[model samples]
Target: MSINQSTIKKLYGLSAGRCNICKRVLIEEDVQIGEMAHVIAKNPGGPRGADNLANDNRYENLILLCSIDHTIVDSKPNDYPVSRLHQIKNDHEAYVFNRLSNNRGYFEDLLALNTLFKYIPILELRGMAMELPSRISNRFEAKDMFDNFIRGNPHLYPFKDRQLDRKWCSVISNMEILDCWILGSINGLNLITISDMYNSDPIPQPCYNIYVNDERGYMALNKRYLSPEQIDYVSTEVHRIVQDFIYSHTDLVHYIRNNFNEIEW
Candidate 1:
């Protein structure tokens, strides 16, 4: 028998209108690009077919995939075996549910949370922050790093949980401020200095001579510089912001770990 409308709805809805494999958007404003592929073929000679399995068109026996993935899986049934397809379906649905539901304790949630790190350079930033004056060769490069972080906002996994959402927002906000500060300094609208004190002495003490600029103060500096004490204060604040960003990422990872429970295979 052909798959019923209710089964089709469940397949598409549970997959969240995206391909189960590549996570590509399957449904758009004027197009439907999703294909429901059978895990066990209806005919015994078809890809992944079985001789005794009955009612092959049920939801449990199907997966939603993009046109490309559907073609790939059907063309290579040995690689995309029945067990593997079912696992993919379960994981994708769990990821969708974790994003949408408040309950939030799926094994897939940890994977989803870690996936965000791939889109941005948080680890690189943390390393640079630790090395401080020695790591930053050009001030504009630091600005570029922050720009990358801001651009990754659109690609991050959408967390529907209130606490997770709040932490993500705070991370984005702090990154924006740092980006603005670096850009302002580069343009000579504000001043930010990096230096190594005691360079003349045998032991060089690397230091970041940062200058604080409020939103309005971006134009106020106007190529002027700050005193040594003022620089030290601003540098401390900037370092704190970077620390907070790192802490936020850590907090998100811990939150996912605390709620994680293994899915039955």
Candidate 2:
């Protein structure tokens, strides 16, 4: 049996598209330079091969690597034993999940820090404001407060100086969308019409629409109006971004907390 597409996807995702051995990124400029190296050789007589091992193409038996590392590992099977390879794979996958995944555990440690409480209210208020139509004014207030905090503190802006990982880029992009929506941009026009609020039927609307201007042009950001589903999605996304930001820039978050008394709200 050959390695299937699902297994390949899992392998690449778990490895974060990097070679397990050298931690070098396999995909460069949209070109794939990574190879799937088998822990147990596909053929019985091949390197690290055994008659007992069957169906070696499974994800559990595969490791992602650069062509160079693949050749080296296969050539010197004695040097890289099955046990060592398994350990390496486990460690690499764990590293990717904890450090690169959106739902990482890094932020959990920061929960105990007193400084974390300072920012929680802003995130909560923003979420609550979006869920209720009566709280529309609160939404604008929250946006201003959030923007001011980010603008006033230069240290919190990590995306400004260096190249960021894909995860961080996604977080920042979502934040930009949230900011745009809060500023009252319906579609790309920066103008909201009465028709934007109501559909063809005056009552019992199928969906409430919020538009965002993406590369494909204006598209619905949220389909439901002040819905629990929309609120949950926004809350989850905001929480992820905030948690990751705190984990990534712990010192900066603490800076805000330290000067909280002096900063004008």
Candidate 3:
């Protein structure tokens, strides 16, 4: 089957407009330069033709390569085997994703928060809820409690959880905090509730649960490894990214304002 424009566009975006093999940046000027080479040749004797074609006409089987690298891979298909090509593709795509999400142009704190903002929406859209600490009241309450918890009990909030796997949960928690903070800032809301799902107290003892307002919502707190100072630093950085994005993409601002309310959060 012929490769569709959607497949091509998806491959380009997944590649971050760069060649997967040589990491050569593909821009409008070099539009005609890169080739999306198939990992498995379409020849009758090729390995895994059926499976490869099933995925090849799509993104997974295609690898973005410059003209030189494309010929090289195709020529030495034995040396650059399918599994090895897959590893290269996965690693390259991950590198691209990480770099764009965690841009270091801003200060470290701001850069992290910027990354959080950049990726959290994508994650949310993917059906992974931004899981926060047990019951963090409002945004202000979350900031105060989280600051104290992370600072006071760093040992408790290790990168690993009970399973000792899925260490990314800690990372997700931090991103969720940043996401909540951004939401509060954007909506001009004072109190941002992280998670209201509390059958019982989610946070246990040794970690203090200072009940500021039980009537307001459920309140539980533990550590997530971010300080108030970092929050303050990131606050300025958030403003910078938002302002820069708005200024550079005025059409986006217009689009957003045009359908501000119609957008489903």
Candidate 4:
């Protein structure tokens, strides 16, 4: 069976643009010279033939290789057996995956730092006078709430029904992010002056103008900045939170629907 483009692309990314056998960079000047090699030849009576070809055209059975190494491995299957090739492919993919994860974390940390820079200035510029310390503490609380939400930590909400309370409180906590943004905007802070942390995804028109949102509307705002996989993860989580809120407070949901415009959050 022929390998589809999707499988080939996944193998290309997993190999991290390098040859699995030689561990050499496979692309130069945007031209990909690497080849996809089958760990098990499809020929009849081969050691790793038909029975072992379940994932033959998939990432699991594919290895990236330079032109020379591809010819060498295919010619010397006895030397580079199936087990050895699998080991090499897995090890390389693991290393690349870890490196990418670490880099992503590093990038997120930088974004957090930039957000802090914007946040601190807004608090300071507000000039809360005697309540400055308390206001700053509130800002810290807001940031902590957001941090816990993003990291999937259960927030400490003081109520008998912890699950529902957390779901409700999470919505409130997210509101604070917007509260700070509005405060900054009102105080003549250039919209451009602040990092577009909240605006990473397109802000819903209502969230900007009217400030009304249901769980899905909120999801559109909070999860807009996430990657497709991350969006799926956060979507699942937010859906659960919304479900919990609805199940616990069915009457309130109806009330909100009827009086949402008049109900000042």
Candidate 5:
């Protein structure tokens, strides 16, 4: 039996408008959503079965993901950078085309549209659907979402109800923020350390937080071990990192001081 609309919507809302794995937010103009997948592949029972996935609809068992994610999860035992990821992508592409040719004909209809958009970069093409399309035959056409995602448009995706584990989210977001600060400081695209930020005093929390949101502040507030001076230096380094490039220490410092834009320091 097929999962129903309410079930899909419940997953979409639980995923809260982002791919549960990649955190890519879907929106209009590009990047459509993909299918609602089974955490356990349907072929486990030799054909699709309600009993196989009915108990696994919670957000933990489910993930709202990009089309690439569906191919990724066809990973046996499901993990990344694994050998299976490559094979599944190639195979899924072929399978999708086969399904389309059988069900929707070789011409571009619903299934063919889904198949073509799944593999093609639909962002460059005349899109199949700019917004969510109304269902045909009471079934969501999977390809419509695929077309939108390929084009970089956003869409809502659902997953089973469960909390997202945010530990890595915090880490990655902070890294991006850190990278932004470094890029601004050195402007040279070189590495800067956390300790460097503290050397410069009077570090403004807001300046750094914008890149990663409040994660940096919260992390600093909790780690009270460092001295005020050290933290200040680290904060300044962060600012410096975001402010100028770091090709050579002497050159960058000379450049920044020489060209200090009279912005924050």
Candidate 6:
């Protein structure tokens, strides 16, 4: 998903290259400015009114964050709570500078999201491949057979719908870290490749485990899988991820919104 370019400039101006959560002053050359955050999220209807300080992109609502903070708040708003957003307005006021309102969001004790980067691997792929039960000697046939089995029976596995309910802080934090890893583009191919018997698609390997991605179109497995427009798709993901580093907000839905229209044969 993507945001307007103006939003990026707004956030860059606000944070001045420093991460909002960690309060670490990132040297313009050193800190990688990641995203622009909404004090009150638009989804789940947090608040987007111009009259609301928390919702508007004023200095208070705006913050310059790293890739980690960007993903945490974007994916897990509750984890990066900020009560000060409510303090922005009363029932009638337009710009409540210091007083702050009473509304609620992710303003609890665990808002710092950078801590999770230490553990998350950045780019990891998890997929199933079909292989012989060890009795088959060719090895090649076993892998191919298992791959066929998985593709034929995707419904047999539940890996796609699994969820973990850890503390919001941990979950969001890791997600943020993962976003950076995908953006790192370090591997020979950038994203750590994973094999799949059933999932023929190659996902952009970010740090956090993909909990839910309704995205469609384009998965290029470098090793043994193929999908429609795989090369173009992988290239696009790399470009978009780079863009993500400059802007504070990246709406994946909006980013890949057009993919839905393609006819997948």
Candidate 6 structure quality by residue, lDDT tens digits, 1-265: 4455676665554444456665455555765545556765544455332344433545445556567766765666555456643332121122221223211111211111112112222111101011101011111122233335447545432222122112222323333433343333223333332222124466564333211222332222333233445434544544443343223222322222232232121
Candidate 4 residue lDDT tens string, 155-208: 222322334335445544444543454344333223211244345544332222
Q: Arrange candidates by lDDT, descending.
A: 1, 2, 4, 3, 5, 6
In candidate 5, stretches whose alpha carbon ends up further than 4 angstroms from where it belongs are 45-61, 76-265
lDDT of 5 by residue, 1-265 (tens): 5566676776566554555455566444675565565554455441123454554544334445677766666543435332343344334445545665544322222333234335543332212111111101111232344435436532212111111113213322433444443343333222234553445543343222211213322111212334566445555544443332222223422443443333122
Clashes of each: 0, 0, 1, 0, 54, 23
N/CA/C clash count, model 2: 0
Q: Against the unseen true structure, what C-alpha lDDT does each candidate score?
A: 0.63, 0.58, 0.51, 0.53, 0.39, 0.36
lDDT score, candidate 4, position 239 = 45
Q: List candidate 6 segments past 4 Å from native.
A: 1-14, 24-32, 44-58, 84-265
Per-residue accuracy of model 2 over 1-265 as CA lDDT, tens digit each: 7789999999999999999989999998999999999899988888899998955789999999999999999999999999989999999999887675433222322322223235435334434433422223323343344456457654443332122323334434444444444444343332222233233333332343454334533233443444676455445544543454444344443444453333322
Q: List candidate 2 stretches off by more than 4 Å.
A: 101-265
lDDT of model number 1: 0.63
Work out how many backbone clashes candidate 1 has: 0
Candidate 6's clash total is 23
User: Model 3 off-target regions past 4 Å?
Assistant: 28-30, 45-55, 104-265
Q: Model 5, residue 262: displacement in angstroms?
A: 25
The C-alpha RMSD of each candidate to the native structure, in angstroms, is 14.7, 19.2, 18.2, 21.6, 25.0, 24.1
Displacement of the residue 3 alpha carbon in candidate 2, Å: 1.0
User: How close to the true structure is residue 248 of candidate 5, measured as C-alpha lDDT?
Assistant: 28
The residue-level lDDT of candidate 2 at 182 comes to 45
- Candidate 1 accuracy as TM-score: 0.42
**Backbone clashes in model 4:** 0
> Which prediction has more favorable lDDT, 3 or 5?
3
